[model samples]
Target: MKKNYGYARVSSKEQNLDRQIEALTNYGINERDIITDKQSGKDFNRTGYVTLKNQLLRSGDTLVIKELDRLGRNMDMIKKEWQELQENRINIIVLDTPLLNTEGKSDLEKKLISNIVFELLSYMAEKERIKIKERQAEGIKKAKEKGKHLGRPKAKYPKLWEMYYFQWKSGQITAKECMEQLDLKRTTFYKLAKDYESKLIK
Candidate 1:
């Protein structure tokens, strides 16, 4: 017999899944059939989702999610999983997007709906990536204005850095010669020189 199952997800344990759970239950799905995970939507390595897909769902079963993003935020993975489910003859019902519900739909209707959903999801995922990049760039700019160092903390200079740095600065030794003596990379040697100068300014 065909069955209905629900899946819920939250990025963190602290995030509430009540709304999703409620929606699934309101859709008349039993609580026991609902699988949930509290982890990232970055990838689908989630325990609940994996178990549900691998162990529980069978051909003719319907999977329910409150929102498309509850399935995943990764557009590529989402499409991949959707294709797999379709190949397995399982159905999907996205509660928030009524038109995306596949239960009781004919093959032609399902294909049309899937295409629309895929296009919409792709658009959303791209916009999300751009917004995240913009926010990160803004944050970096603010941090720089505040004189905060970003990314990895600087490595401590080699034991001979001070001596080599002075020799290099005074033209007593070439930059390459100083780096070879101090066992520093080209970039690290220059960065150390800049830091030493900053310390002198302080």
Candidate 2:
């Protein structure tokens, strides 16, 4: 008998896998036959999906997915994976769009339709990624313009700045001595001192 397997994925940890499970169950796939990944669908590095592919796949096997996007966000990677499964004689069943079944079509028709869907998905995923990058860049630019510090928590020692200035002016005291007096590590001492120096220059 041919083994039937189901795959489900979510983009984030905050999303629940229950809905997908329920959908798969309603579709007549058993609980044990469905492998779920509660992780971003960006890559095929999913352990659950990999394990399912390895153990459940054989010639004439059927693999079901909730949707094409759930397989991967990258269109090229998804196409490559789909081809690999087909080469192994595994049929793909996409439940959301029942007509997308690779087994239900001729080889040429399957390639053409799958290619169109792949292009559309890849474009969408790439667009989303670009938008995110642009938003992040705009936020960072605005923060810089407003003089907001970019990263790391600000130093806790206001007094250290004053002590550093005084000790530095006393030519005899070294930076190490000033740091010791301020009870700060080299990094913290230097960071505050640099910020203070920048203020003086302004």
Candidate 3:
């Protein structure tokens, strides 16, 4: 027989899962068949989600969530996981988004519905990311206008860095010579060189 499983998530341990669990149960999912995770929606590393996806769910199993965010808040990651689950032939149903439910849908219907939802979701998520970046930039501008120091202080260059840096860049001196002069390891010398070169390019 095909099985149905419920996955519920709360962003933090202090938050209640009562609401999500209640909805899942009312949808006729067995209490024992529901897995709950008390963790951030930032990633899919939660114990419950991992176990539910890897261990419990099987081909033809239907996974239900109260909301799409319960799958994850990061849309990019959510879309990846969604694709994986579909590939594995597991059905998905979001209680709040009935259009995504695939339990009894034909294969063609499932593909069409998921594709449309994914595209719409990606568009919205990209817009949200842009808005967030714009808000952050505005905040930074205000802070700069107020003359507040932001970000880390620039890392000071080591002694005798300038002369050796030029020599290394011009290939007049080997990298080993530059590292030995600056008392830097090969990795550190190359990283500093890259950072310096990037600044020069800018």
Instruction: Please tell me which predicted candidate would have the highest TM-score against the true structure.
Output: 1
lDDT of 3 by residue, 74-105 (tens): 78768888889999999999999898888889
Cα lDDT of model 1 by residue, 26-145, tens digit: 999999999999885445468999899999999999999998877665787688888889888899998988888888999999899889988987898899999999999999999999
Extract clashing residue pairs from model 3. none
Q: By lDDT, is 2 or 3 better?
A: 3
Q: What TM-score does candidate 1 reach?
A: 0.69
What number of clashing residue pairs does each candidate have, in the order they appear? 0, 0, 0
Query: Runs in model 1 with CA error above 4 Å?
Result: 40-44, 140-202
Higher-TM-score candidate among 1 and 3? Answer: 1
Q: In candidate 3, residue 117 scores what lDDT? A: 72
Full candidate order by TM-score, most accurate first: 1, 3, 2
Candidate 1 clashes between residue pairs 3 or more apart in a chain or in different chains: none
Give per-residue lDDT, candidate 2, residue 154. 74
Off by over 4 Å in 3: 40-44, 144-202
Over the stretch 17-132, how does candidate 2's per-residue lDDT look in tens digits? 88878888888888898898877644546888778778767888888887876766566667777778877778888888776787657778777767766776678779989999
Give each model's whole-structure lDDT.
0.88, 0.79, 0.88
Question: Candidate 3 at residue 191, lDDT?
Answer: 76
Off by over 4 Å in 2: 1-52, 70-80, 134-148, 156-164
